[model samples]
Target: MYELKTKETDDSVIEFIERVENLKKREDAYRLLDIFTETTGHEAKMWGPSIIGFGSYHYVYKTGHEGEAPLVGFSPRKAKISLYFATGDPEREQLLESFGKHTSGKACVYINKVLDIDVEVLKDLIRQSVTFLQELYPKEQR
Candidate 1:
């Protein structure tokens, strides 16, 4: 059995954000906190040590792996801020076209700071991700 490392913890989201060494990154973390909470309509929670997550869902893959994960989240890292969103949505890719100054991997979008991206597009991405995930795993979302 594989263990999921990113399980939600009782850690303080504000403490984690306050520990961010960079002043701008720290500020952006606060901004992102507000954005994710307001957009998801869920209070922020700490998913692991660093990730500030909002909302959650349980997902079971065809391979029998299942776990709970955030509908949306972000981590203000040393290199760049990592934005977590649902993967495999074509609409997400389309929104990224206008998202500005960000690089994305399979499941995360990395940005230097909040000012580097369009906040409206970020909001749309958050909205679309929540909708897509909730619809994809309707019974599992809470």
Candidate 2:
């Protein structure tokens, strides 16, 4: 059996943000924490040692792999801030067109800082991911 390495932990999100060596990244982490909290209407939680996450969902793939993951999250990394959103959603791609300067991976959108992207677009991404995941895995079922 494969283990999920990024399970949510009872770590202090503020302490994690405070430990960020870069002053700018540290400030942006606080900004992102507020944005994610207000947008998702859920308190932020630490995923693994790094990720600041909000609102979790249970996912089960057809291959029988299943686990809980944040509906949306972000990590203020050394290189760039990584935004986590639901993959395989066409609407996400559509919204990203106006999301300002950023790069995308399989599941993460990387931006240098919060100022580098549109906050409204980021909120949209958060809401869309939360809705998509909630619908996919209804609360009762989870």
Best by TM-score: 2
Candidate maximizing lDDT: 2
Candidate 1: Cα lDDT at 43:
93
User: So what's the TM-score on candidate 2?
Assistant: 0.97
Quality of model 2 by C-alpha lDDT: 0.94
- lDDT by candidate, in order shown: 0.93, 0.94
Q: Report residue 134 deviation for candidate 2 (angstroms).
A: 0.7
Predicted candidate 2 versus true structure: per-residue lDDT over 1-142, tens digit per residue: 7999999999999999999999999999999999999999999999999999998998889998999999999999999999999998899999999999999999999999899899999999999999998998888875
Q: List the residue pairs that clash in candidate 1.
A: none
Candidate 1: worst 10 consecutive residues by lDDT? 133-142
Per-prediction TM-score to the true structure, in the order listed: 0.97, 0.97
Instruction: Give the TM-score (vs. native) of candidate 1.
Output: 0.97
Q: For model 2, which pairs clash?
A: none
Residue ranges of candidate 1 with Cα displaced over 4 Å:
140-142
Candidate 1 lDDT: 0.93
